[model samples]
Target chain A: MTNKAARNLFIFGSLFFFVIFLGLTVDTMNQIDGRAPEITKDVDAGKMVWQKYDCIGCHTILGNGSYFAPDMTKIVEQKPAGYLKQFLMDPRGVNPKAAMPKLGISSQEADQLLAFLTWISKVDTNGWPPKPILAAAASVAGQPQSRGQQVYQSQGCSACHSIKGIGGTSGPDLTKVGANGKDAEWHVKHLKDPHSVNPKSAMPAYGGVPEADLKELAAYLVTLK
Target chain B: MTVKYQSQKIAQYFYTFAIVLFLVQVLVGIIAAVQFINPDIFILNFNTIRTLHINALVVWLLAGLMGATYYVVPEESETEVWSLPLAKLQFWATVAAIGAVVLGYIWMGLDPQANKTVMGTQLLNEGREYIEAPRWADALIVVSVLLFLFNMFMTMLKTKKWTGIQGVLLGGLVFLALMYLPGMFYTKNMIKDQFWWWWVIHLWVEGSWEVIAGALLAFMLMKTIGAKREVLEKWMYIEVGFVLFTGILGTGHHYYFIGTPSYWKWVGGIFSSLEPVPLLLMVWDAFRTTREARNVTNKAGLFYTVAHAIFNFVGAGLWGIIHTLPQVNQWTHGTQITTAHGHLAFYGAYVLLVISMIYVTMPAIRGVTTYNQSRAYLAFWWMTISMVFIVLTITGAGMVQVYMERLMGLDYEAVKTVYNMWFWIIRAIFGVGFLIGTAIFVYDFFKIGKEPAPALAPAEQKA
Candidate 1:
């Protein structure tokens, strides 16, 4: 083939391909365009909160973001709005080991984010981020240490402690502390004054608690394992 | 040798800067890999390191393509560059824009809300993958691209000489600029936002960029191979045809899981499977032309040119085909499989193409025709081998993830425990190899001061 003929072929081929591409693009646009779920004002505000906090930086809404955090596309269906709000309010409060840092979003902003997530849950993800299989939580609530659990709860231990993945992350996860070698005596001392055991511990002392309550709390802590 | 057009000299500067950025990208990539093992590496955390790595790679590749364009256009047009000053100005402005974006990403904290009040939108990182540049940086990118397109358009008009190769390449650039606009649009719906986002990301990587690659490949073949222009040009058109026919619609592959319609599963699966056809054609055409012109030298240039084709096909083609089917992708969509394909495909296609361009142009720009043989060979083998292992390690990781997460339905932490060893292996072993190979590649580029230019072969002389 001559150079002129080759050039002509290229032009013709490119034009033909361009036409096909244009048709496909139009078809795609038709497929996606105007099919978006209507965005309510609350959802719109919530989306800004979502972007403002850059939630997608860590979380995947519809399979597009870092894998560092769990997918949020179906979060609304997975958890209650109140649960999500509290989790968003202080992620470490619910799961101390959670990598999600507090964004300092206000209650209002959190509501907006909830709205956004509620909207997102409606979008069809084609059943992605398959439901995780987690072992049922061990039932220690009715054990002999139940009084100690009451004392633990009364003291607002959740602010700095977690048991079976339920509570704040400001301190160590106590779910396995009993098995990990924190004896009753150690728990008592640590609870009374955390600095006595670990100088760098950020947990404040519980010295003002009654001696009986402290002993009960220590016993309950040891049963966490 | 052809006369050294002033714009070509300016192109050399861009190429050098690109190499520097390429090295930076590798360093940052290693830092990110290390973070996979130990996330507490001072302020150079995973998010920061990764953002830098991704952005640097994107910008550096852009710089390389622009440089390659400036270098190739004048020679193909048979005229001096139209405005060397405009090219130089565009180069600096482009560099400054990339610099602002990179620095902004590094200094800005990972929390999207970290500096919203203090920096406003000007400096707050958006945290979008590959589009993390702040609003100001986005503006700079648009401006720089516009300047680049204007300069190239004016150069062509002034020269009044255009080949089929130039037409395709310049057209690709115009498309590139146009596609980038969609990324700036804001939508309240996350799914809708992601839909438009792929217009910029997928379209650039798989669509218009392939045209650019086709044009560049055609130009390079015309220079190095003694084969008749008609045959190569015809093959170039056919390859472009495949690229367009497959790539534009192949974007549906990404739409499969991103809240798009269910029909996309069929559309994406069918079209993306064909995306590799053109790459395979390029592989055949490049090697056939090289074999036909057996007397040509510049083995380093020839090596990279041919290797790019093979790697691109394997990484972007075969690996891509493996998961392009919705059945496979349903399990692998966001897992390490995507990462594996990403690392291989990007390296195989875009990264290697830029490196190939550097190999082809650097020696010529320096008034030599070839690299130091042993070092270039070491660089090539090391990079090629390490890249293969990197792909394997990540693919392994992805496979394990798919099994534990999708099949077993384990939670994220449970899957992490199963895959931690693979991540460690990738970070410690393969990451180091990739870094060393990249280092050698950069070192080889500058290791030619004492080498002398050899006489052109009859084939090369005709070019």
Candidate 2:
């Protein structure tokens, strides 16, 4: 190509694509409120809290941040809101092994951040951050997890406790908890009120868990032996 | 060693500060890598460490580019910098900004939310990944950049002559400054925020930054290679044009999972997939130009040019296309896969270009024709090999992360802790090697031509 031709190509090509980009950007703005939930005042406040602590430095939200933490897009669905709030307030207190730092977030700010996260959870991400395939998580055991195990995961139990060398180390290892000779009744009481069995328990009460899920979780704990 | 204009010496100060920050960037990287293994151990915390690492790299690279422009523009335009004082003022302003960011991060305390007024008053971060700098810092940066740009423009304006290579550089600098403005725009919508955020981040790195890099590479090629100006200059226009044409639309890749519509899948994939075409031709162009070689004494300079071209193709182009297509990215979004691509592409495209500028420009600034390039060669090979290892290890970590966490239903924490720890250790080990190579390069840069020139003193003095 001649020099002038190359120059024309440069100017024209850039302008052409940039204009298209601008068009798509406008279209995206139009489609956004349709694709994702509307931003509430609480959600706006939540985004402020998200930025205040520099969460994206360690956490990926919308799959766009660093990989220091898990993706926050579907976190509201994966984790209980209460658990998330507490985790945000006191990361190590909630899960002693958590890599996150306590950003000194207040209860109000935690609520805002959670709201933002919830709003994010509803955003249509084009099927991104695909669900973890069961086969890979259970690949080591070569067996699908039991239903109670599913309940444990769904209930965010692993945020504080461990099972068979997996999960957090904040709470007792339930790998051999059945050997403790605790029956389901006692386990249920511990779930509802950890201080009932152990006066020094730092674990928060999981009383709000649905009674059925609580019962299933207690049943699963005794089977750890 | 023949100094064209006194203004070229102004670049030395910028390079000095930039090299220092580059060192800090490497040190912070080592710390971050170690923290990856055991997070609770560091007082800095992963957040602080990560912010520093990224922020330092960004500043150092920008400083390097700014310095490089000061060095190259005057010669290309056949005039002195229009305002040497402004160039020096920019250097000082940048240094202060770096200090404020580093100190504010370290001593600003962990509870920035509680100290909201303090953070805002002090002009600290708002926590976007590449753009954590607070609005105030952003403004300060904009002002300084404008001052720097104004100086460059005036210098170019002094001589009403334009080279294709210089024009690209000037255009890239203006684009660089303009792109920063988008990041300043705030939106209540998370998707909208990210969409605009990528405009600043992706557009700068993939679009404007690439143009600047192409111009720098062209400048070096012209200096060290026997290729005709028109041939190299034409290649410049083509590559830069393709960069923007494909790159502007290619930003849809970031848009795909950020709450944008599904049309981005096709728009992003097609455009981004075609990005490698220009890059591949760039690699071929570098080869074609190099084959028509002159008796180039500046071997290190040539090495960096060719290497930048090849790696720009491999790192940014090849690795990028690997996941740019939506099907593959479906599994890899936000995974370590992105990390692998980011490191390789940044180091290859920008970092190498910066180092090459120092290699090619510094010797003349220091008036050293007898440059002992043996140490430079050592540093180059060491860093190059170490970078390959670093990238491989990270890529290994990324693969395992994709397979275990995304593919498998493993807990995210378990995938990071149980699976990726070993790779992190390997990456940190090679991180040390990369640091050593950088140190050698910096040290060698100072000692480049301490040896006296050959005995042609009569002709030199007579002139």
Q: Score the docking of each candidate (DockQ).
A: 0.25, 0.65
Give one digit per residue, the lDDT tens place, for model 2 in A1-225: 799999999988899888988888888888899987778899998887788788888889887888988888888776667667877888777667777777788899999988899889888888877766665446456667787777887777775566765664545667899889889889899989887897655667888888888888888888878
Error of 2 at B58 (Å): 1.1
lDDT of 2 by residue, B1-463 (tens): 5559989989889888888988898898999989888887677778888888988988989999999999988998999999887788888987897798778777644546433644333246777888888777888899999999989899989997799988999999999999999999667788888888998998999999999988887888887765788888999999899889899999988887888999999999999999888788788888988998856766788888888888888899988998898988888889888898988898888888898898888878888654677787888787888888888988888889888777755567877888788999999999999999999988987787777544544533332
Instruction: List residue ranges in candidate 2 displaced over 4 A.
Output: A134-162, A165-173, A192-195, A198-220, B109-122, B452-463
Residue-level lDDT of model 1, residues A114-220, one tens digit each, is: 88888877776676655433311223333454789889766766544556645544356678877977688898898788779976444557789998899998887
Report model 1's TM-score to 2 decimal places: 0.82
lDDT of 1 at B182: 86
Chain B TM, every candidate: 0.94, 0.95
Candidate 1 residue-wise lDDT, B36-87, digit = tens: 5555555644666666777788888899999898888887776677778878
Best by DockQ: 2
